[model samples]
Target: MQIDLLRRKIGLNFNDGFAEVWLWAPNANKVNICIQKTEHRLDMLAKEYGYWYLKTEQIRPFDAYSFELESNTDADNAKLKRADPASIYQHDGIFGDSTAFDLGRFEWTDQNWKPIAVKDYIIYEIHTGTFTPEGDFESVINKLDYLLELGITAIEIMPVSQFSGNRNWGYDGVFPFAVQNTYGGPQQLQKLVNACHNKGLAVILDVVYNHVGPEGNYFNDFGAYFTEKYNTPWGNAINFDDAYCDGVRTFFIENALMWFRDFHIDALRLDAVHAIKDFSPKHILAELKQHVDKLATENNRPYHLMVELDLNDNRYINSQQQGGYGMDAQWIDEFHHTLRVAAGQEKTGYYADFNGIEDLAKAYNDAYVYNGQYSEHRKKKFGVETENPGEQFIVFSQNHDHVGNRMLGERTSTLVSFEMLKVMAGAVLCAPYLPLIFMGEEWAETNPFQFFISHSDEELVEAVRKGRKAEFSAFHIEGEAPDPQDEATFNRSKLDWNKAATGMHKTMLAYYKTLIRLRKENAAFNDLNRKNTQARAITDKNTLFLTRSSEEQIIICLLNFSKNQQNLQLNLPGNMSILLNSATTEFGGPQPTANAIQHNGEISIAPESILIFSN
Candidate 1:
């Protein structure tokens, strides 16, 4: 069998300890290869094809190994010292050797675990680095008990792949298979997943398959892994449909499987799927879905593959039987836009297209603003009507990108009134789709989630700072952008765990706990079947009423967009009872008044408030 190595001219014979290492030297006639393992000389055997094979019987894990390729013709030949591309454990840095440890050494306690179905999922998207003060996967395990108590069924962690330097947001990952060495590596991640499962929480990892980081990317030396056929905002798009695309697709699929099989991750939240351009007969997304389904079936677990697409394309989440990409769910930006616009908040960028109560109603009912209609933002006809059920959409009041992309990374709580925040949370948790909460969103943490990275190159740091400032110019933000490379940027992003037990944070946490309890206990909230959902506009541009009902029970939700109180008339056939109210002081409301007002054919609504009535 012939296997092409990644880079350099290295050939190894499994039958012999001798391997041959070569370099293309058109001007030189003689060359020598020197192998060293942490100052120890190893016996090397010369083999054909200019390869030097060394005996590995004495080599153990974490052994630092490097080769010095010399040319006899030039006494001052430049030495080539490179880390193993297949290295599983990198302790000091990128310069390490491949460990031959067995992956099955760890004993997993989640053999009987099964993931919660997509319909029943309540995901919490968190960054492991900033989720806790400790900033590691093990620290996340220490916090899983809180998530379970808060009723989150799934934990969607941001990317944790290996990237340059010790710290980053993880989007600039260069090694797709290796876990970040700074984050305690593969064994630590496995422990976190097992801990989550033990607490009845599923783990979903966010993966970036659009483009690899510029630094530490060596795939080009091995094969044609990129092309100029397509481009994206980030850079030249990944070569998904060009020559050798099959190998690239397999690499990603295998990486996905590794997360599930090796680390026990229950699902994957594919980052920016729209940027993943592919024109193959079987789209890369479909191919990935097929493999994921097979793996799920074989393991007898509810494994899901969710997508983050800005195109508003419903085909991505539609059923596979209907000839659509078989994604379990997709992020619904419409929901966030509607709530933001209705609350009379930020109007920059995409939020410009969403305003007034009508848009909010449309987003809540149909889950899309375009729906085959003309879009003023794109200045073209966009988005197909989503035939998928509501559960196919993952709705959120705020996420990492929504807040972190801002000029100062201000959360929704910072922009809206305290009462409005509760109303937004009520709307989000009660919606038909699966809901997600950003890390500090539950308690309205005041700390900002700034964009931070640790790059070794000073030039790259300056360029990033300048780019961020330029990007914010369109929004008319004042002042200079914060330096992403600054240590303070990363330190500020860490969650102050002490806040969770005091003041507004405590109140917000209680509110979230109550909402979760209501959702779990009430049949009306838990029933995801679309037939039970019905929306009625109370005012063309100020208020809307959403009613979800199950057999012998009904939940009516009234949402007021106005900033002042308004008198609302109820025309229901049955008696009504107030189950939840965002206007209460318990949820940062003004004060507790009439908790339950009789139908009386009329009800008064506070400005920018939400009311949930059940009978």
Candidate 2:
């Protein structure tokens, strides 16, 4: 029950006619719940282990309030007002007052929904701020049908946690529990997730635990929420192993479980976990996994935790009983890096280390390309050898990091030719890994996913621009870096929905739909058992032919990344038939006279083309 209280309790809990507020403020001598409009103050009772509680009928749903704190850290030990760190909903925005909300008030019809396994996840990642013109949760609900038509089984939303101002990448969130008020707050988010569940589309929320935004962070005033012992790219690290770390740990762990318990989210994507510094025996990641799995069992639904780490550690993907963090999967950058460099991407920064075809083959056959190998980029040996299949890795040719982090914010559509795009698409989907397609990637939306955040603080804004400019010196990027603070930069990043169904965009969208269908309809595409899958790259021909079988039928994908046409011979046991042909006129091909798939012997592959054959 102590653990359940740690997970299920906290924040404002409403029952019958009254609201009960729970808070963790170890450093505060006294705390008062203040009503925003009337200034009604209610003293909270302090309990054992630094917990405080107050039950009052005066507090009800949608009541805007803030905490009045009397702390020893103050200049005269004077009282100050601050928004709840565990606020469920904010009134105006993160800069405004936190509000009380009742989850029971909302209606939901997805009680009988059953989500698919992690291996079957075809994730379509969306940045809620730039996904639509309105850029709110209610507006995103209007487009869920369009996503389903694209053949995506899961929708991974970029973090919606409350950050400063109206717009942000959401990595700068300070209020971990509060939904962004600019995105229609918590109620609208609930509607969006529930609607997605009803449409048989699982929802994955991107969350950042590594660091918090500079503005609107009141954790320092309340307790020991940060540690100066270690330094990250974001300056001070979170207090995970320092004094009063228990409350800090529980606070984050509870925030994770609250999403699954209250909002009904299927999975969470932990962002940039490589920056997370923890030395405790029971890591914060393991604690989160343990709590999530417990909640999953109680709710009787599938729960997944996917980390964005460059460490290439299988412990994240391994089962808990095996002494791992028990994460269902992780986003591996090697597959995308290898495929891009092989497809003629400029070798800059870490891209310098990847050996085009060799790395591609290694990523396809094994989960990592640098397992126990020397990394010229980092000037050291990186990663441990893992026998785990592609199921443990989330591979993609294009993602937010690869595109948004670029100096010019150019996607695969802008970087590569039309023909090579199809080849890369086939490689991503055909590989034995969980495939994730970024928003507007299906129809090849031309908008650049630039780094933008609307912070009201001018000093912080200047710091961000200077940091970005300093960071750009390392990359081979052309043109002036877009000012992340400018409204034009944020507006320009928004997807052009109308263009998604016109000319080549329509054709590309159709081609992507077909690829997704093949992956979903065929069992061989997702059968991630490495023992049954074979990946061979014909280095001489600059071609890759990956084959997967289920003892019944074999799925073969022949990809030609070369600029010139190549001829390859197949030594197969069964009669091969074409499952999908990228050289067909339907996908804007040259209308080749010869068939794409040959049963046996020799086959001609068009330049920068792909062909999927099943036997």
Candidate 3:
């Protein structure tokens, strides 16, 4: 099997009283393993297919080691020393040597855990470093019960790959296999996943396979792991279809499987797959899906692969038999952008292409607002219509990218009013697609999730600062951008959990709980068939009507985007009663009397509020 063959082809594999070490260095004349804190060295014999291998009894578990390579060509003659690209544990940070550890020893208690259906997922995205003051895997385990209480079915953690200085957003990670040492290393992460499964929560890990970080990157010295033929915003694209690309593909494929097979991850949210440049006969994503499907079949469990794609193409989520990549789901950023624009957010950058509620209504009808339509932002016709089901799309009002990429990283709570916050929450939960919420969003957190990085290289640090300031030029914000390299910036981004217990924050928490409960208990909300969904926007009244139905029940969500109260009377089919009202005093709005007065198809809706009704 390709899975078993790839697993044993690279890195250090420990057996009975001996260890087998393999490294893929197509351009190296010789390779040697240098033991940490000792003078011991082992020379590896070159085998076929440019693979260096050694079977010796000297290496043991937890043994720190580094690879020393001799150059084969005069173009690059300098001898190189670096950690394993597939290191499982980098205990002493990214710059330190790699450590060998046994993966089969962890006692997993999640053997009986079953996968949750995509239609029933209420995903909660979190950044482990900023989730709590402690900022580690063990700390995250302490909050699994809190998530359960909030009615969250899945927890999607930001990338935890080993990066420099332990303060990155995880996109700057250089090591693919190693878990961040500052996040309690591999064992603690395994414990957290195990604990989440025991508490009936699924875990989705974010992985970046488009490009590697700039700092501590030694791929250039090793082999052809990068290609100059394509460029990404981060830098050169990964060598997916270039020469000697088999190793690069296998390396990342192993990384994805390791998370599922070793760490027991339920899903993987692929970061920025649009940036992955590949022109091979079989795309890398399709190949990955094939491997994951086989693995899932062998284990008798379902493993999901989700992607973050800017392009509104359905080929990523379509089945392989239908000439697609076979992704389970994708992040629908258009829903968030259109919803924000309709809520009176500034129409700058990509938001300029959207025009209020009309675009939002379009997104409700079709998954993409720009399906083969001209976009002012891109100055071109973008996207194609797809017939994918609603459950294949994940929608959110606020996420890490939408909030953190801003000049000051202001969340929706700080950007909009309290009533509008309730409206936004209701808008997401009532949609046919899967819903996701960012950390601290339920209680309306005010802390800024600003961009921050901690790199030791002064040149790279300065470059990041300048690049951040330049990226914000389109938004035209006044004050200077936050210093990404500053330690204070990271400290200010931590969530203040204490705020959730007092004042409006407490009320907002209750409102979110109610919204989540309605989504779960109501058949109209839980059923994800888009065929039964209907949406209409009254532009003059600045109102939107979203009606969803199932065999058991039917519900309608009325949203008022204006800041003025509007009263209307319309003829309808059945007698409707209020299910939930955002304008009630319990949710920090006006008194209960300010709520809708429904009588004979006539009602009054408050400004910037949402009212859900059912028959």
Global lDDT of each candidate: 0.74, 0.86, 0.89
Better of 1 and 3 by TM-score: 3
Query: Model 2: residues >4 Å from true position, as ranges?
Result: 5-7, 592-594, 597-600
Clashes of 1: 10
Ranking by TM-score: 3, 2, 1
Off by over 4 Å in 1: 1-59, 64-87, 95-101, 593-599
Candidate ranking under lDDT, highest first, comes to 3, 2, 1
Quick one: RMSD of model 1? 5.1
Per-residue accuracy of model 1 over 23-132 as CA lDDT, tens digit each: 22222233333334556554444444333445454444334454444434456765444443334445555545433323445689987676677778888999888998
TM-score of each: 0.88, 0.97, 0.98
Residue lDDT tens for model 2, 1-615:
045722356777787777888888988889999997778999999987788889899987888998898988777999989888889887678778888888777798888788878778899999998999999998999998998988988999999899888878899999999898889888888999999999999999999999988888888888888999889998889989888888888888888888888888999999988888889998889888988888888877878888999888888788879888888889999899999998999788878888787779888888888888788888899888888776778989898888998877888899888889988888898888899998888888788999998888899899899888888777756567899999999999999999877999999999999999989888788687877778788999889888887767788888899998887888655577777779778898885542664445778889999988888
Cα lDDT, model 2, residue 434: 90
Query: Model 1, 404: alpha-carbon shift in Å?
Result: 0.6
Clashes of each: 10, 0, 0
